[model samples]
Target: MDRITLKEQLEKYRTPYEEESAFIQDFIQLTEDPLAFNRERLAGHFTASSWIVNPDRTHTLLTLHKKLGRWLQLGGHADGNENLMEVALKEAEEESGLKNLRLVENSIFDLDKHIIPERPHVPEHFHYDVRFMIEADLTDKLVISNESVSLAWFTFDSVVDMIGYNPSILRMLEKTSKSEILL
Candidate 1:
């Protein structure tokens, strides 16, 4: 999908009220076009993730990515699937091991693109991340998956104070706090 195609799709389905569709639309756009990432090499490598807000609304869960070692929300690459939301949900379940998760289908946020530093075989990279907000019951014990070094619940305020979270996480926390998605 070229920029024109992506922009047309964005304009077509992207609304302040629609969530999943808009995210997937943008994800498709970024994956199709390289310029959307603002960096030349990041054309096709796109991903999606979810910020699983707890029932209490006071805290949000974050995973310390084992490879990146940064406190971040649960998400990963799309692997060329058309079902981007499923990708986000799957990542959340895999990373957090929480079965009772619920995605707020209408509470999607903007797509964020960030650089993933070059590595041995992967060349310099960036991820055009489509992010969503989900409300899950704080109803079960969370088992951090191998992909994460540690898992912890941080209050919205604490999440803001956290040293390594990307700016989009803060935006997600702010957006979720204002929505009725929290149980």
Candidate 2:
């Protein structure tokens, strides 16, 4: 997908969250280059993440990111991939070591823009993250990659306690709660 296509899709995305709506607008207006993932640009970049849930929708996979030392959803840099959905699924599989993952919806599940603190050679920058919901069997064994300290599934009800409360996670849960996929 090209930038135009992405912008059209994002514009059509419907959500009750005012913040997400504003994010979409900002993303469309901020960068005109297609290679938004280039770290050298220093104008922020696009990232793809999955809010991966078990088949029963009771638990979700999270990775204890080694670099950031935080429990976050599975995802990574776009790496110049214009198709964000494909990026999300690829990251999910690579991070979780799971197969047969299916998208819960074709549309984006969430949107967030956060600042990444500078580390060594990597300078500080913003990440405009696009999130999607993915479902996988709970029985699948997880493999922790070098990028993460560990990987685990947390119950939807206890995720906040397990990983600390995050507004993005809460917003994703709120949005999915109203859908049949989560029900």
Candidate 3:
């Protein structure tokens, strides 16, 4: 999406939250200089995702991203919806195929900033992400869709050890451990 298209979408989803506001303000500044925004950063990619903690809290589920080919939390494009919490919940359900999982309506995980790496087919842009923690029953029959190469549960310590994971994932780990975003 172009800067103008994304800006309009983001404006619709704008909430009272400071993080969301900060994202818009920064984006407006960035978009004013198209070449700088595209050359120096990512543009028009605002996403939300969920770090779903299983019932036992012994493990968290992750999707092995098909394109990125790394184990990561569930998330995707907002598609113009500004209710980031809803976007996260929708992604969790679509990616995991676990019907019992649900995002707590009133609570959300904190926002984290990351840059999209330059891809062969796409220019790099900044990712302004709003994350959340959703909960699910830990049954052995969890199914994953094609968006991921695989899905698995990992211990907290194991998650911390992942070498190439983005810092935002680590932040979610710390927050999830503290029960700041989960019930």
lDDT of each: 0.68, 0.83, 0.68
* Cα-based TM-score, every candidate: 0.75, 0.92, 0.71
- lDDT value, candidate 1, whole model: 0.68
After superposition on all CA atoms, what RMSD does each candidate show versus the true structure? 5.7, 1.8, 6.4
lDDT measured at residue 119 in model 2 versus the true structure, 0 to 100: 84
lDDT of 2 by residue, 29-144 (tens): 64477568555657689888999987677888889999999889999888887788899999999988888899988877888988899988888988999899999888888889
Error of 2 at 79 (Å): 1.0
Per-residue error for 127 in candidate 3, Å, reads 1.4
Q: What are the clash counts of all predictions, listed in order?
A: 0, 0, 4
Q: Put down candidate 1 lDDT per residue, 1-183, tens digits, no spaces.
A: 334443454565453434334345545555455344342345346577888887667888889888877898888876655355677889999888888888766433556656777767666676867667777776578998989889988878788677455666766766777765654
* Model 2: colliding residue pairs: none
> CA shift at 114, candidate 1, in angstroms?
0.6
List model 3 lDDT by residue over 91-181, tens digit each. 8888988788766444445565566777996786677665777878777466788898898877878986863566667766776667645
Candidate 2, TM-score vs. the true structure? 0.92
TM-score of 3: 0.71
Which of candidates 1 and 2 reaches a greater TM-score? 2
